[model samples]
Structures are given as C-alpha cells and as structure tokens.
Target: MSTKPQFGADIETHHTRFDVDRYEDIYVVGDVHGSLDALKRLISRLELNNDDLVIFVGDLVRKGPDSPGVVDFVRADPCLVSVRGNNEQKILRGDKDPDWLREGDREYFESLPIAISFDTVLVVHGGVDPERSLEDHATDELLTMRSPHGDGYDGPFWYDDYDGPHRVFFGHTVHDRPVEREHAVGLDTGCVYGGELTAYDYRNDEFRTVASKTHQDRASSKVVDPA
Candidate 1:
C-alpha cells in the first residue's frame, strides 16, 4: 500500500517549513509590501538583539515605493526570515524578474519557506484550511486564501472557522487592524496603504505597530472583526 507523500519532500514541490527554537524572542511582522522606511522605524523600536529573531509574514515586495530596498534589507540581516507570499510567488512565476530586484535577491527570495513553525505557532503568508493538515494545503492556499469558500471579502473568514493544534499567524488578508482569533492572528495591517505596519510579539502576546508613510493602494484594505 502507498503511504501519504511528505510535503516538501522534493525541491520542486512547495510547502517548505522552517523550525526556529533558538531565539530568545520571536516577532512576526505583518506584510511589508515594500514599505522600507516604515519597516526601518518599526525595527528601531523593537531594539532587537542577537538572541531575538524577526519573521515576516511575507509580501515583502510590491505595492510600495521600494520593493528592492525591502528585499535588500531583509536579505542582509541574518535575523530576518519570511514565508513566500503571493506577491513573491508572482515574481517567481513571471517570465522575467522585476527590474528593481538586485543581483542575488531573487535567489534569497526563492529560499523563503512556505511556513515557519515555532513549537505550537505556525506562520504562513495567507493561511491554511483549518480542517486540513499542512501537507494537504495547496501552494495557493498557503499563499493567498482568505476565505475557504471563495475569494469574496465577506463574513465567515477562515480564522473564525479554525480550531487549531497550532495557532496560525498570517499576513495576506489586508485589514485596517489586526485580525485576532484564539487559533489565528492576521498581521497584515495594510502598511502599504497608509495603515500601520504591525507585528505580533509571540512571547508576550502583544502587538506593536508603526504608522505607514505612504498610500499605494486602497482597494485591498478591509475592516474585519476579531473572533
């Protein structure tokens, strides 16, 4: 009898997971969306140390003024890591790389995993279907699914439906404020759209934000209630 295939078993298949346990503190940032200056200010406020790590919920590029700058900054710092957001996936799938992407930046972006796991916490760019295992989730689901039913930005979000063994932290569904739930937390506070760039302190169960300096797109913004 055939057994279930392992996710990320091959280099070609997606669903790669990273495990981080050495950090003294772990902070998961919302979608950067190329808001480099805002990200700089937020990092300054954090005053992170060598023992601390900062993880991005993805969408590090596109929508803001400095996609290349954000990519460079994150790549230069060893303390920073990210999951592959839909925007990043777009770059990977496109026939040509973005004109702004510097040499070697594409490879670094490609290296990003689909999910980052810290014991009971799971980080993804979008989110998983609560009822399915990580291995069962498609690449699109891990990178872009907001509602399990369809892409409609209506009631009954996936977070409301989630009853998790691992509390999920995601950033694709742009919100005016953070999406807070018992089993999932959404950190995409629409930083590229003149909203605050937010971060979640996993150890303290707290949130921190830095106000956006630019408004690139208003169409993606949403105001949703926490579960």
Candidate 2:
C-alpha cells in the first residue's frame, strides 16, 4: 500500500495451496518493491533456460513504482515460483489495504503460496518465525515475520547458522547486503531502495547484480565458500 506496511496477527488468507518440491537451479530474487523496470533488467540478464527454476523470496509488490507490473511478469513467467511477500500478504489479509492496484490484482496476490519447502531449503519472503512448528506457522508468520534469535534452524528464511544440507535464501532486510550465514542468506540488495538486485548462481556458487535505476544502492556479488 501507499502507507507503511502493518503485518497483522490473523493469517487465514494465506491458507492457500503451495508446492511441495518443484525447483532447482533456483534463481531467487529479494524484495522487489514494484521496480518493474529493474526486475525486467534482472530477468533479461538471466537469459533463463528451460531447466533454470526460478524462486522469488516474496515482497514483490508495494513501496515502488509498478506493483501491478511485477505481478504480471511473475504470472507470465512459467519458470518462476513465487511466495506471498509481506506486502502482498498485508493486502490479502485486508490489514492496511492500499490502492496500489486497480483491479484483478487482489486475485493475483491472493493466489501466491506462503512457503515452498524443498528438499534442500525453504523459500519465503520475510524470515520465518521460530516460535512455531513448520506446519504450525501461520500464513502471517510466513509472510511478515522475522526473528532476532534466528541463529537456530527452527524456521526457513531467518537463521544465520544453518548447518543443514540445503541453504535458506530470502529477502526483506536490505540493511546487511549479501548476508551469508550458516542457516540462511538474504539477497535483497535493496534494489528498489536504491540498492542493487542480486541473483545467486547455486551450481557455480556465484553472485551477479544489476544496478537499480531509481536508487543508487550497489552490491559486488561474491561467492561464499561452504563450511
């Protein structure tokens, strides 16, 4: 919405369906606050192949210029798998709704899943809350929750000490650019907030970035050696 986001406690709107495990070579992006132009530039950079599965870490709308455009792109792309971002969740749950969209947008935002738990990792918009079980986590928790003591592996997109086989990738916190923790990694790059939008190449363990047009945020993509 046009105002600052307010994530409410009720989370039933996110009780929708989701993917059990349907991605690989995942090209995950962080917090796209309606930067349709920047998103297009990043997508063009990908030159994605049919096998390159794309995962979006949510917050794909609001706070930027083109909320509707972002949704249109995500809907058109077959290779893309998106989770319900915190902003989208706010609209879906009717907590602080804004006129960011004209019409038909609510349906699109309402359709997104809360989480996509894979064999390797869990993909979410904001960090997952550790206070509840994976199944116990409400859509609100998955959509708009973050924890400070996220060093533990109780949830998907929060922890910094993930020692499991798969790595959790997400966005929402652009304060720390390219945070590489053991439990989870944040790649927001703050593109829409004058930060660069980042992409992590999992197979090659590489990072790539495209500068934002609206903002001057910058990030030099680097590989994090696995411990």
Candidate 3:
C-alpha cells in the first residue's frame, strides 16, 4: 500500500511535489514498534550512514518480540534519535510494571527526552498540542494520546483531522494517507499491526516503507497461523 500525502503544500503540486528543502537529511521515521527485522531492512535500504538523521515516533516496545533489540540499536546508533512512544512511556512511568520484562528497556525509555523538534518539522509519539504550552504536557503526553483530544484534542500526543499550520508531524494514529493535519504528517503506518512501516524524507518530502513479514497486531503476535 503506497500513499503520497502532504500537509500545507500547494494543492496543485500536492501530488506533484513541493519545496521540501527545509530539512537537512531525511526527517526519517516517526515510530517503529518491535519490528526489528523491518527496521533493520529499512535502514539498510535507505543506506543510512553517519550523515543521515533518523527520528523514531516512539512505542519501541511492549507488544513486539524484538523490543530489546530495537532499544539497543537506537541507543547505540548515533544517527537514530527517538521521542517517547506510548508503550515506552508507560513502561518508563512504571505503568503496568510487568516483571517479565527487562530492566534495561525500562531504564532506557525512562532516560529519553520528552520530544524532538526542528526548524522544518516536529516529531513525537503523539505530536504537539496547541491547547497547552510545551511544558503543560507530562512525559506520558509524549505517548498514548489518541485523536480528538484525550477525549478530543489534548495536544502533544494526538493525531486527527484537526486543521492549522506549523506542520505538526507525529505518530500514534493508525491512519489513512498519514492523516495530514495543520502542517503535520503521521507516519506510524501501523508497522507492528500487520501494516507497512513508512519513513518520510523530511528533506524533500520523500518516503520509504517496509512491509510487515507476518500478522502481528500486537508485539508478541508474530505468529501467522503457520501460513
């Protein structure tokens, strides 16, 4: 499934192209769950080197099998940067406190920055919220927020049909056409949920996607009935 989406770019050139040179390297990925194989393959395909920058949308663990693997790669890779995903946030905040999980994963997440922003784009697990200031949101706001506020539009951690500008890019909403809102783009693409994982070239508005290998709606649901 391929989708060429845009935010406030010229409607005439919406499908054609836009002046996306505002960024340095590719804006890269928004979020990736435990799809380690897919993530590795994607990075290889992109030819990611020391120069390029990768921004993860969040949710690096909790439902997928390679949660630990993903964390290790992100932490070690200098080019790969990530905001807190909902699952990561929950784990860091001691949400479920599952004893079966690894302590390193929890510590890694707890140590992550709240959000990532740039002159040309903004990145997060949820996205930015206009209702409140940046400091108004707690760490959990960096993840787990759905569309339409907490009940509607909370800010920072959400994606939906909201309209504005500033190109608020984020993930968390498994959506159609990356769900363009204001000046934002959502690339969560539902990678771990049997959907494609997409990475956008924030530099020129380009994108690369990696297909799922099996039916995994949750992190641990990699089994495809032996098909």
Task: Please report the candidate that would top TM-score against the real structure.
Answer: 1
C-alpha root-mean-square deviation, each candidate: 3.6, 8.3, 9.8
**Can you write out model 3's per-residue Cα lDDT over 33-85, one digit (the tens) per residue?**
77788888888877766667787777766555687788888888877877677
Q: In model 2, where do residues sit more than 4 Å from their true spots?
A: 1-24, 130-132, 148-158, 161-166, 215-227
Predictions in order: lDDT: 0.81, 0.65, 0.61
Native-referenced Cα lDDT, model 1: 0.81
Q: lDDT of model 3 at residue 162? A: 38
Candidate 3 TM-score, true structure as reference:
0.73
> In model 3, where is the ten-residue run with the lowest total lDDT?
9-18
Off by over 4 Å in 3: 1-24, 98-100, 130-135, 148-165, 218-227
Query: Pairing residues by index, what is the TM-score of model 2?
Result: 0.75
Q: What is the total number of backbone clashes in candidate 3?
A: 19
Could you give the candidate ranking by lDDT, starting with the highest?
1, 2, 3
TM-score of 1: 0.89
Q: Largest lDDT belongs to which candidate?
A: 1
